[model samples]
Target: MSDATSRKVKRFSESDRNSEFDAATQKALEEIDVCQNEIDSINEKSSEEILKIEQKYNRLRKPFYEKRNNLISNIPNFWITAIMNHPDLSALLDETEEDCLHHLTKLEVEEFDDIKSGYWIKFYFEENPYFENSVITKEYHLDSATPTSESTQIIWKEGCSLAQNVEANKPGKKRRHEPAKTFFSWFNDNVDPYTDDIAEIIKDDLWLNPLQYYLVPDVEGDGENGVDAEEVSSSEDDEEREGGEEESRNQRK
Candidate 1:
């Protein structure tokens, strides 16, 4: 037998119980707990400092975000395109919802005055046949590290309810246990705030850096031509600006 396998291991009987450690070992364990408490205290302070830092940057980013929204508004269907490009958000969208999202003009995320309190996700839409409301907002409020959310009720047009169109658990269907909720249904369902994947994905991923997703299709098409992604994205911005200027010039003419 190999030395590793041949080695005899000590096996203690179940009755071999010691409720107490030797004095030195017990003292050392107490000291270790004290050290861990100190470490935890440092971590708590660091978290507060980090939140202050985020609040500072968030204020600085506001004007740039506003300018970005203005610029993107010149690019038709910009919000819908970006939302569609996101893998997580795209999976939730069906063709019916995609049609509705085409009218989405702007998307905004705003943190509460107290950065730790929570944030809001706002979707602005042009006057569309799908819904009468001009905007829909979902706010996630954090209370003692627990999250809760509420959203604006959609005043959907007559006979144009996207949520009602979702088909689930039908016999003879290819996917019998398909998800009943469409992307539109997200506005209403808040059963488990912790498991609200759509809100989490949107707030964490898409809201942080939407420009990357906005240029996804352009980057894919330009990859074979040896064109840089940044260059393509820059060109897209330039084109949108020029298009806006041309529209203005035409109005004057």
Candidate 2:
């Protein structure tokens, strides 16, 4: 036998129950793998527990969500004002999206650091009968193009699947605002008709399902959701200046 084999055989102790019938190195490695499997099993159990907790949490929040939905139905321009309050999102939107915003029950945003993989936005609905598909998801691939603003931004990493799809299927000689052959464009044109030919069938369907209401809206509106840092700073500065002026006036009086 080889010297290595001789060493393994010498290391294996028949008297030691831990060694069993295997070599010392083999026994140690096998036990480590067994511990790792236990760890993995416990991790899976934790994941299951988290999912159960989330389901219960949703069930508890459903009543409040429905109550808010009812209030929104009664109060005109409720959602409109909410959307306009956010400076960044307001810039991207116009008056044309009023009707579409009404039926938009829920929007979920999942951000990924891997720019190549990009971000996923899932729109959930209560009763959208016009479209056969209930769920509409859009994936925006990160691009390395120059940002319009001078501030540092997380520009998308290019050459991913999202970019490739857009490049491969771009419409020939399209105008600046003209719709391209992207999945988002298709969703906007086919499902979300902002023009005169609006589909009431989907709206009526959504009206009956009270459980589809959402408490919090998505921050990312078509990828531009957050207000600029400068705007926030300016607002704070104005508030501070007003407070200081009021204090000085009170002292003089």
Candidate 3:
């Protein structure tokens, strides 16, 4: 038994020395003087490093994987309905060709660097009305769903005001009552006929639903007071600039 143990120790020590020698040889190969040769060696080293990193972290990042999957799965179905009913934004989705729809549907939020940073929805369709360019790519932070007080207040006020106005008018009174619809429904009903076709398409597509929450411009005051478009534009610009700065910082990192 003592002799067997000695043999096992000898084998392990031999294996360890072989590993150290191989590592030293690889390091020497990487230090080659030729630029092209060095580049090739570096590429090989990088690939091996990447494989090691992936093997180590792939299981660790599984939570982010499940979170993104849950996010996509739990997205409300009504969102699609709302998008279809959006006046200004529905047209952008409508002009998208069938090929664009297929691509959009196949997009999955992927994890990068253990951060859910590269998860983006990209729409590549001609004549996109929502943005300056025909292609729209938007990255959403994982924590973007956390509501701010201002956003919560705006949502509550809009929904409550609309509901209150609808309930206030007595049905018995012979009021020239146009059907009281929500701001979004009214906008959809009133938009140009040209957009109606696209709006219908938006209603049918599932991918567009995820964007519905951002479809309508936030309205302030009742129809009597009206909203200031200039103020809204200025606020939007500020948000865009802040977002741009954040993106720049992220790129540097």
Candidate with maximal lDDT: 1
Q: Where does model 1 exceed 4 Å of error?
A: 1-19, 165-180, 218-253
Specify the poorest-scoring 10-residue window by lDDT in model 3. Answer: 147-156
Clashing pairs in 1: none
Off by over 4 Å in 3: 1-36, 77-92, 95-225, 231-253
lDDT per residue as tens, model 1, 1-253:
2232222111111212452666566556555655666676789899999988998999999999899899989999887888889977888778988999999999988989778887888999999988888999978877666567777878878998776532332223353223336676666654445667778778888877888888886435555488877788899999999999999999999
Pairing residues by index, what is the TM-score of model 3? 0.25
RMSD (CA, angstroms), candidate 3: 25.1
TM-score of each: 0.71, 0.34, 0.25
lDDT per model vs. reference: 0.75, 0.44, 0.41
The digit string of per-residue lDDT tens for model 3 on 1-253 reads 2454445445545565556557656444334323445476679899878867875686666576556546644443333334444554444343332222332212233334434222333333333222233444433334344311110111222222222242233323343335423322322232122223322343344333445443544464334336476766787899999999999999999
TM-score winner:
1
- Candidate 1 lDDT at 187 equals 65
Instruction: List the lowest-lDDT window of 10 residues for candidate 1.
Output: 6-15
Query: Residue 227 of candidate 3: its Cα lDDT?
Result: 46
True-structure lDDT of candidate 1: 0.75
lDDT of 2 by residue, 110-138 (tens): 43443233444455544432333445665
Question: For each candidate, how many residue pairs have backbone atoms clashing (under 3 Å)?
Answer: 0, 2, 0
Give the number of colliding residue pairs in candidate 3. 0
